[model samples]
Target chain A: MKPIEARTERGRRAPPLPSPGVRFGEGFLDRLGRLALRVRSRRERREGGGEARLLGGGMEFVGFRPYRPGEDLRRLDWNLFARHRRPFVRVSRRESSERWSVLLDRSASMGTGFPGKLQLAAEVVLGLKAAANIEGAEVDLHLMVRGEPHRHRGRGAALAEWMELLESTEARGRGGLARLLAEPGRFKDARALFLVGDLADLQPADIPRLTRSGRDILLVQVLAPEERDPTRLPEATHGDAVRWADPESTGVRTVRLDAHALAEYERGLGARLEAWRAIAAHHRVSFTTVTSDTPFEAVVERVFAR
Target chain B: MSVPQVAAALALGIEWSRPSGLLLLGPAALLLLLARRSARPVERVTATFDLWEDAMRRIPPAPRTRRLPPLPVVFAAVAITCAALALAGPRIVGSDPPRVFTILCDRSPSTSLPLQPGRTRFEVALEACLSELARRAGSTDRVRWRSQDRETLELPVGVKPPASWFARPAAFLPEIEWEREDRPGFLWVTDRVPTPSPSHALVFASGGRGVPGPVASRGGERVVWREGGLRVEPAPGRVVELRGVEAGRLGPLARLLTIWARERGFELRGGQERERALLIEAGRGAGETRELRIAGGSLGWGLAGTGGAGGIAELPEGAQVWRFGEASGGEAPILVAGSPGRVLLAFDGVRSVEGDPALFALAWSRFLDRWVLPAPGVVPLDERRDAGAASWDEWSEDRFEEVPRVGAGRGETTSADLLAPALAGIGVLFATLAILLSGGGISWLRGRLPASRTRT
Candidate 1:
């Protein structure tokens, strides 16, 4: 076969090149946007820790006041009694040395794929540890997994270590909140405690016990979309029989999930959420529900912004 | 005339015989005698004038064409001829009458009448049929008996030794072993003659149930009821009852019963044991079209509450939405784009969710669609015959008739008797019209003044 030579017509012209000015690029705003996040993180550190001021003072005796009825007797200031007629507890510039404890639920229900409840809980714990560590308060992180509770001291780089552990964790079994309550010394010396879980298998006692020590307790409930509504199921080729196995008890129940039953399920799940809300309210512990469908960044922004 | 004589005369094609024609001619002669006695003539005068000088003045008259009145005698003669012809009752075609003797006996349990002097209903019917052949049959004629199983069999015409016979519980089927050089006339014998066609004369003997088939034509050309030994029922009754006779033939009877049941659109299958589960991929809206593919059942497309097009069993447990159309892919749950009239969901083993207030709220969400059933609780039939909603006119042209028999082959007459009567009737009407028209013309001619009269 002979090769054919290609030639352009005399009157034809080449297409003009694209203008450089009109070209799209990662612009200055994009670079500055990165710098802006760094500034925000630095500002967050400055305003975030309530303990920084308390830890900044170098041994100045500030003042004293009479200890309240619920105050720990170990905190009665003997030096303040010499100056005042009544026995008093020391009130110093180094605001009371409060210990921080973070309790996380590691139940199987929290292991949903996106905006994971476990991951959200870990992030909240990290924030609390950063606040406590900068303020000279001791921090402890505890995981309410199916087995025994795992505790880690919130020290230098411990938050990252804890995050790495959480990242590597796999969801298995159930009975999270119950197991956490059963373990002794898990919430030791905690001035304030944060409990994070979907509270699927949680009992009424689980909430009250954490706040019973008079510490300011916050219960952050994390749930997946299925946990919240559970009526939404994907299309399937199989038949009507679906087996729901209880992660902890290994109990299985087969049910027909038609449209009517799905509606009923949603209604009941709503009632359960409301009941949880009411229980937390009565105990005076702050309660909030976090959905797994929300991005983790949005959740962090909302919680930290408040 | 005696019955056989009358049958023979019919076979000979003498419909009116000689006596009937004479009877018609007698009336014609009486009418002729009356017309001759009533005739009378009245005279009229006419004046003639002579043309001469004064005495002969001419009277000029206008020429008038005188028409002659029709002669009634001619009409009388024609009427007489026609009356004789009508009395003669001529058959236009020649056909040899059938010599076949078809005895149809009812072997049903209802036919087990103890009044007959035989061992069984089949035996009684057979004996009666055989005896009829012995009494009235010609030397070359044969005897056909309605077997207990409702089929026909022929017997030897002459005095012969008893042949070996076998009996099934339902009926008897006789097979002849020896072939004689002279074959007797053909015989169609059956118990409860399934039907009486134009071809066979049905001698229905059993008083129990009538024949189980369509009414057969009865005429000299088609059929003649065998008169003396066995009685024949004219028509097959509406309902047919079949009862299994006794212990010996129940197995074969059961098979026959099964065949009948299948004919009535009942199907029997082995029991199914496995339980099935459903996997439904529903879209966002309840009203959105869904494609449901059932594991064991049909794959169909439909709305939630409405019944679907396929053979899918009702939606399975744990299915939030029933799918229809084709299966879909890509992460977002199949978004039912439209709102349906109604939606139903089944929770997979999550009993606690039944009472969940949240699930109900989500189900009623405006974003979701609802599906309405055109008719609720109506289960459609799988087969076309059982589909009660279908109109008769909608039935398939194919297979509408149960047993399609081969019609008359080329050059053969399917029904000469039927066509012959219709053609003869048409010819008679035309002849009547011609006679009336000719009679009218003759009457007009008779009313006119005749130029000359020739007849006496």
Candidate 2:
């Protein structure tokens, strides 16, 4: 038989494209607008073993009481020490960190839950950008894409432009944070760094690479609730067969979601988080892991512990 | 009724006291349907299965459930049915095999003697026989009573006996037929146990006690004594002769005697009389008008207490004195026994007796029982004065043995009403099964059972 000619209506439109906006209420943006940033860091000396002070240097001079043992000798007010027998330093800066860095993981795993991890990552980015503006720091935006990362340095990209870029961006390929960081000539050092991702394919040794001795590094690990506890998801049943499809790869697994299975998952997830916490502490990096359902303000507070 | 007709009606029969209670089944059926519908298949989808993979490696898969629930619905239905049936009050409707009762009662003069103050020995025996009959009696049973004064009374089991069946004891008991004995249900009730204990008849003796007093009807209508028994109805055989004066001239005495004669069921022929059994005179005897003292034993013979005859009269030769005048001691008589073959009550007005109808009746009763009847009269002797409260065993004969009664045994046809509790137990059993099937109690049972036995 001859191939049938097109008899269907050409006017039938293709399925409409999805909107590119984060799944959050306007109340979150309002809370984000009211926030201000204050970063504290221990500045390590490159030439010596002992750490040096960065808190005493800034644009304006402030009053001081006494000099610390490990502080730089140049920060001491010599005139005040001559008038009084006490040795006092001039504390002029709120924080020495002038530049902030934000690196977002745009991997397929972030796209895998209701109120997706990617959306939370986007909200977390907005929160950091606002804080950096309040602290008058030049922020650099790095997108860990499938083939290569996109870097936006200093204040060259506007706030509107960053949001537009984040909204338009789709999580496509497997680009874990540790593997991206190990690549040569790709990233640069900054006074503070904000890493937003689910920490997939990460190892304990990679935590030091994200930090310099004087760096104020905060790792905001965003996750879908189901990654930590499957019972937290609506799709889970006490004893039902489930089909799971991995977003990045063609791997599919069939599972019976029973109480035993849920218990095993919880135990593994807990141990994983604890390992990450230990490694982060060793590197003196601020670390926080939160689900997509958590408030942005709460996550920031946990990361800085303020 | 035949064995075949009984067999047809008896197979697995049930009758409900409240058939309306079965209406509960409608709602119960609906409930079963609803339970079945609730068993819809459960399906869900989740994000990941990594931990599930680990758990699955250690534990077995969940058991497959059917789209519809069978265990719960079946249990519920059965429980409802049992409850409804229990409420309905089931009773067995099967017929019993035919039974027979052949009862015989003693008609001796002593049988009329009172065992207690109210009932005679014969009455006590009759009551016992009736009770036994009623206990085991069914529609198919047959009963025959060779009663005291009748040939054979066809007593309907489980019903009231006819009034005609209750006949009085004879003055002289005839030779009874106890040799042609009946089978298992044969019963013979008597005042005294007979000699050579019956080979087949179940003999029950009342143990005769007390001198015979006034005999009452089963309904307690008391009557005067007549010879061997109180209220004994004799055959109409007496001829009353009027001598020396016409019955018309005797006036009230003649009329009063006529009424008394009718009341006693005796047809007394007067006026143109033939050779008679009794004689009455208006004119003289030997004594003048004087009250006579009664004999010592006169009271026992049912005379008016303390006093004697109120009038004087002549008595026959070889007279046994019952009453005496003032001068005569116990030797002279106002009343006496007549000749051996023929008897008379010489009721002459010259005896000067007071006009007391009840006394006349008492005197007449004594005269009739002692002189008129064929058998010896039962005098209210002092030997039996307090026999009312004494044990009946006091009068048992040497051969008498009291037989223990197994009430309503063997061929009794009554159906039991124990089905209610059994139905309730069945309901509880169904409820237990339901609980097991639902797995509500499975955790408690888990320790006792193996891992493989658990459903999920």
Candidate 3:
């Protein structure tokens, strides 16, 4: 198999690319507690999933409400009705199977840079698993690899094993995001969909098709620092020349690593970003660049905050 | 024999030497505004070879928000900067006597060799010097040099006499009279390296007539009439052997020859081995009385009319008579001819010349000195070469620094206008920048300038 990254090259102050088990800071799991999830999707994912409460009949009491003329008489509280001589209804929160389908791209391009995006993808998946455990939501992880998708489907109890599965997942495939999302039943009826990838080959026209109507779609653009701006790393000594080999294909680019080229690259990148933004906006899909260098918990927060 | 010389140089700041330079910034700003540079577009000019030049020039300037091309910006910036500096005078504060350079005209024997047809080595070097130095002031930059005839010309460079002022037909000697005064430094402008290496002070050069070129051209004998007496000398480095004449009778003739030989570094070869030896046999005066005469190449070196002569010795056929003197019996041959194909001379024993032996000996030796020696610059005698001759290789190189120059400290610090030199340098740089930014350099590179609807 080809190497996942160019080399173990990084700036002096930058942290080493996280390995399969790079230790996180103390209270990393506790920090996960700070995250809150609010799903706007009213669709039911499955029979036992924590779906939105369109009609509630579970035993857990959540609140009381004034009775409406069309309200079912079974839900009215007799005690409250006698005291105030007013009709009152008992409201309880519903417990349903609300599944979150996260399509984490494992394309070869994501694996090809300093502090490779593959590492960030692993961290993002671990984060979603933890957040799902807290919200009592089921996670259906679709690792977008070549051939068959590597599926890790579960709720709270299986989350630890799911984290291990994500950590072990390598960026060893090339799945053009547009092609994968076009497949029928891509997410298996999940309430919300989170798409994570560097999106090297993704087209703006594919945004609407990838985002389901009435579904919460958060598309996270995982970029290594060098990818966002080639001039940021220590290796970017301008006026020097570098020959780049494309990881997704056999194509290569010979560039003068100078200020002018860097500027032009940045301009093109901005245009690419705007393209993603405009299309994502039209589709009601939230899109953002999630860099690898950021703290994992903060990265997780950014992913959900959208 | 030699002295060490002057020194080596290599700054910046806000001290405005020419404050008026600030006015330049306005004009510079205006020019930049009118002809502002723009970033080069990163597109290939698809126009064919013919239209490529036009297309290149027609590349529209970058947007105002973008950066300008560094080359034109740098040049324009520097040009404006220099124009400012030029307007603002800058001066360094310093003071000291300007240097005194003594150009040692190499009168060394080797200089006599003809480097080009009709021009000796010394003559060529002298003519080369006709183009004056950088033309500094006489007071500030002094020059001291001696003509080939030994007349010293000392004056500042600008005020010094022109090339014509150097006396023509200068003579060469085996050695030059070095200055004994202990000046701190001086520059040695000689083809021959008189010194060993850069480590020590240079010294007198070796005696070898290095690289025996074409057989030496005869630099005729020189004789001058002085106030008190007549001074006579031969073409330098001539060797002659005397026979049958006693030194006691000849007065100082013997001593003079010894001195000339030592001075010119001439090798005194044995008479039998000599190729151009003069044979002079004393002849008996015994014939009828006859009037005498003197003539030929002998008159070329101060010899004049002869007195009436009588019975002397007769010369054989093919023997050329040099001079005739009055004798009791017949005319005596003062200087007679030598063997076939040779110009040797010997006085046949009847030696009283001008009725005074001493005067005749003196004049004759000086006269014979020319013919006696092989040509003046013939193959230089091998014996004169010493270990010091190795330095000849040093001269083959252009490393003149190895030979010491006149040593003089830069004078005491005074307020020398530093602004002047800075402005001068900036002016040069600005010229270069102008050429570059104005597309003159590009025209040269492209082989042809982009036509502005311009005809070839």
Candidate 4:
């Protein structure tokens, strides 16, 4: 019992990984991308075959298009006939030519890898795009990719175009998760605002505000596996002194991780997790953190489960 | 001691013994009890609160009320009281001196000077003291002595006199002056003047080595005067012999003698030259036939007798002796017999021509009767008397008076005997002063201090 507490204690003070992707190197990132692609394909196959009318799931309607055979006959544009008198079918989906925003956190913390948190984050966005494509949801990309990525939006096939664009972008340094959520353009169509980074950056008070204006928020926290179970194995007994950078500034403070300190960290970490769970539960928002070494498929499963 | 002072002390002691006064002891005990009670609370409170530093500040707390130091003032008042009482002459009653002799010899530094070639003032004074002792040889005696340069006493008047009397000048100097002022007509032994007397015999001595001055007298009668710085000399001459003087004429000498005798322990009777005739009539009461004969002289007297009832008499000069019967010629002895009787004999200062053996025989014969008079199995004096005669004087004419009182007619020097009472009074005074100075002073000082003052 004593050793168990000692191990837990040691894991607690283990400093945060340098970046979520640092735990996973290139090979880990490739594996995560492969897993993400598999989850995306499987989700598409299931949802497209079984749930055909997912376009109605969103809050707003996209514009009407020329009617195609086998399109739902009930989605025909009776209103447009009364206005322009054309035999057009209503798109009856959020898929439109409106701009969409993709805010990627390039903070130094995103580099920590086990299952490659940064790679997984990118894959999450790519998967979201793939899922949206089957439901005919348009996508616009506001990429805060490395420094600050620009926003662009367009229609049906262009949604896949945004996913390809996100995959090619690299994660960089220092920006607020709230700054991305607070942007008016991100909520222009009352679109889903998916934050792909450690939700550690967003304070508790910020959650209510993000939801107050009626924007859909999906928080994905990218954490390393060691962060989840920070226990020390016998081989790592001397102690791990980890130096973490501010990600927003040139400053760095060295944190010493040992059995005693680890215990304190675990206590704090447990408290923080509880606090986040409470906030998310109150706001009826979906929140899930993907740890290092977690299969990307598990993340996909968690996102839908939320 | 004043009886009231003793009673007051006894009353205070009795007050302390009672229950009410015993309750006065409660405060100190209660203080201890309260301290004990508060101790646990203080400790618990101190433990419960994390502020140990604040608790320490509160303990043995700061004075609740300001107070000036009263100890010094109280001590001063006490000292004043003691000084006043001392000045008031506090004293206790003391015992009369036991029958003992104190031959105070002055041996100051002044005693070193000589009046003649070989004799210093010290030697002459010592000789005079020796003569005085010889006059009183057989009585229990103690010698007290001092010198300007040395001191000696076989057994001190109290427990002990100073062993190092020469270490200080105080001891012998006062005695010399005291002797000179009090006891005149003897040698005033000292180095310096206070002048010499013509008729008063004197020997003076001085300290430090030197050739003595010549001894001389301006009067026709010559004597050695001084040697070194000290004067050692006889008086010019005896002015006149005191013999043949009338009863009134020898007043001073008799008084001086009586005092000396009282100090030395001889139950003296009569006045100075005031003849007392105790006429013990022979054959006054009928009982066993007993005879007593007293004989001898002014210088030495012998008492002898043949018969069971016997007595001895001492007669000095111009004193008359009468015989009811014929004088038995063998030693000019007066013989008496009868039941219970006494005789009075008196003599002038005339020597007896009787030889030593006859005198010794007479003395021995008296001792023989005196020895048998009070044998253990014989009827004791009290038992011999009848029941009606409860008092001793009713039964016997020769009952002992425990203390002899003197009348004014005799002018003997009772002054010397006053020394014991004087010394005792001084001791009492000093002891009372010492107690008041030390004990009372301390108590009063303690009382004056403020009760709130805490000594940490």
Q: Report the alpha-carbon TM-score of model 2 versus the true structure.
A: 0.36
Measured against the true two-chain complex, the DockQ scores of the candidates, in the order shown, are: 0.00, 0.08, 0.06, 0.01
Error of 3 at B137 (Å): 30
Candidate 4 chain B: worst 10 consecutive residues by lDDT? Answer: B41-50
A218: Cα error in model 2, Å = 1.4
Q: What are the per-residue Cα lDDT tens digits for candidate 4 across A5-52? A: 110122233234333342223464455456556655654454334222
Q: Write the per-residue lDDT of candidate 1 for residues A1-306, one digit (tens) a residue.
A: 111111122332221111101111245234334434643564345333321212222223444455555444555666666667576754443233556677777766555534556656665555555555544567777774447788876655464476566666655555476677677476766766777766766755567656654365666777665445444444112213233333333233333344444444555556666777788767756667777565444543444333
User: Which candidate should be chosen as best, given lDDT against the real structure?
Assistant: 2
Looking at candidate 2 chain B, the ten consecutive residues that score lowest on lDDT are B393-402
True-contact fraction per candidate equals 0.00, 0.18, 0.00, 0.00
Model 2 stretches astray by more than 4 angstroms: A1-28, A37-97, A234-237, B1-456
| Docking outcome class, model 4 | incorrect
lDDT of 2 by residue, B1-456 (tens): 345434543664666657777787787788877776654322222223343344455555544434455776789788888888887766555433344567777666566667768987778876766665565455656677775456576556765456655555323455456665533566776665555666545666666545645332211133445445456443324455555555554445566556655554444555644434445443333444333333343332222211223333555433344443344545454543443222333234322234455665566555553433332233333322322321121212211112211334553433343566678789889977876776665655675576746745
Models 1 onward score TM values of 0.29, 0.36, 0.37, 0.30
**Which order, best to worst by lDDT?**
2, 3, 4, 1
Which candidate tops DockQ? 2
Model 2 lDDT, residue A65, Cα? 51
C-alpha displacement of B430 in model 3, angstroms?
3.5
Model 3 residue B400 distance off true place after TM-score fit, in angstroms: 7.9
